[model samples]
Target: MKNIYSILFIALGLFSCQQEEITAEDHLISYDIEEVPVTEDYTVGALYVVNNWSSNIEEVPLAGHYLNGDEEAMKQHILWADSAAIDYFIFRYSYPTVNADNDILSAFLNQNTDSLLNFALRYNFAQMNLTKENTLEGQGKKEDFIQSFKDMIPYFDQPTYQKVDGKYVVNIIAANQFYCDSLELVYHELREEMSALGYDLYLTGEQTGWTPPARFEHYYFNALDAVTFTNMFNNAWYDRHVFLPQSLDQHWQYSKDYYMDKEGIELIPTVAPSINPKISNPNASTYIIERDTNFFWSILNVAKKNIGPSRTIIVNSFNDWNFNTQLEPADSYGSSSLQLLRNQTKKN
Candidate 1:
């Protein structure tokens, strides 16, 4: 009887150990047969928002909410981004604002002297409060608007500025909100101005196909070299509270078919690590996509598979705790997101 009881205890211990091993192995990402693609030379950039970092955030960062201009924080960020194999940092900017964004950009430029990683600009026109006169009709306002690009020439000339095929990459946020007679003309003029200064510009607009089948004219699509989103959320799925993988996957397919295949505009897909709008946008419909490393891995695979010839993918953000789409190290998931990113990038 004593021998039998001892044997049963040993068996239970063995089973427990096996279960633990399996659980640990499950955490590591594995590729599916279809997912293991003949990898392309892909470039990935993460949106880096410069904010008053001392403010409150629900998803506490591992390093805490440090100031935007903190040199150490910026240095750490650079190191982490490079380690993660991130190609560049896409920063949010606004015209004529010498605020936190400028301060952080200056800090980044000053610190990242060796050009360890590249950087790009995404001008949020929505923050500019431009009137109709400023966009089209007012005398010299059009030129004034064009001059903004010229002002950015110094930054573009930097060794760290992101470029593709000899043209500097610049993105416009809220371009759809630009109340103008011809949005196409505005972009054309901007390009012509840059050309005159011996600089080729690759402009990307962030205003196409929030809804699956885009209704914008063909000429409208021609305004920029490519189109992308800040965060590609499936509104219908969110509204219905059915956030499945297919809900997101179908959107990528739609963008590929409609924007790239049909319209001939390159679509730079933005993949999210996770999304939680509950904190910053309480009044808005509350939706949360829990922080799952596998979810990020899957979305990244989807993005890579659907990428246009440009071979570019934008991670929604590197540090946006408000909407909770950040890939930066957080208290709950320290460096795991970056690790996963590095894994995917290395595989490709």
Candidate 2:
């Protein structure tokens, strides 16, 4: 009996050692199993493209390829974004109000009555061929521009629409199109128009390149409340053609030092998980930025550190599958990528 007792004690000791080994491995896991704590230090938004409205998608979303005007998909996405601690989804909208993107946004707005997560609009000014040309025609177009803002007032009025500094937020893509001498005047006119209607607007312009164009002079800073880029891939500040971690670090500092530090304009830092447009554009460039979670963490670290006063960081996209930069879940990474964002955005 005494011998049996001794053997049992030895077995228990071995089991205890095995449990300790398992606990160490669990600690090595990168993300927190607990719920991500909500953050207020900075706000995170994502560019959500509505390309999945059509069929024949080669890439698979964890939520499946949803149909056009699918409110269910939007709900699923809103839940995911909320879980990831994303503050809003900036929809890529075009004019005419008859496209798939508009349909998606309409459906999303219909179901977003609860204001669970906020939404914003991003217009592609280049595609619209809209510019501030400083001519009689340009002056007429400024009225047209004001009308566009008037049209969007309904969207901006939504309780779920994102607001910063008590003004409705709107992002302008291809902002470099405003290369005319009257760029500042054009924006001033728009602001006055909106103000007359009792609607305040906060315009965030997306321009390519790092340094301010000589033509823009001080007018560029005067035109928009904040400046941002779609992504760093197209920005002309990088030394190497290939995108790398070191290049991004330098780019962020250069942008901050020149754009925000020198000029009083705020900078909404943009970051992307990956970049490979070949899937959509068959003739797309071979240039690609491979996906690396550690690298992504480094990016969030750098972006937060250099982010301007607005304290906003916009992810390149939530579901731009064509460019292969979607943050939405997939079999490849599941929720790990978003969890990284949630984990990093926490100030505490």
- Candidate that scores best on lDDT: 1
The per-model lDDT (C-alpha) reads 0.74, 0.73
Off by over 4 Å in 2: 1-40, 52-58, 130-136, 179-181, 209-219, 234-243
Candidate 2: count of backbone clashes, pairs at least 3 residues apart or interchain: 0
Residue 34 local lDDT, model 1: 34
lDDT of 2: 0.73
lDDT, candidate 1, 213-254, per-residue tens:
464534347677777766565243442234344444566678
Cand. 2 TM to true fold: 0.79
Clashing pairs in 2: none
Q: What residue runs in model 1 are displaced by over 4 Å at the alpha carbon?
A: 1-38, 52-56, 131-135, 138-140, 217-219, 234-244
Q: On residues 70-173, what C-alpha lDDT tens digit does candidate 2 reach at each position?
A: 88888888889888889899987665355787888988888776677899999754544544445424545556666878899888878888988898899987
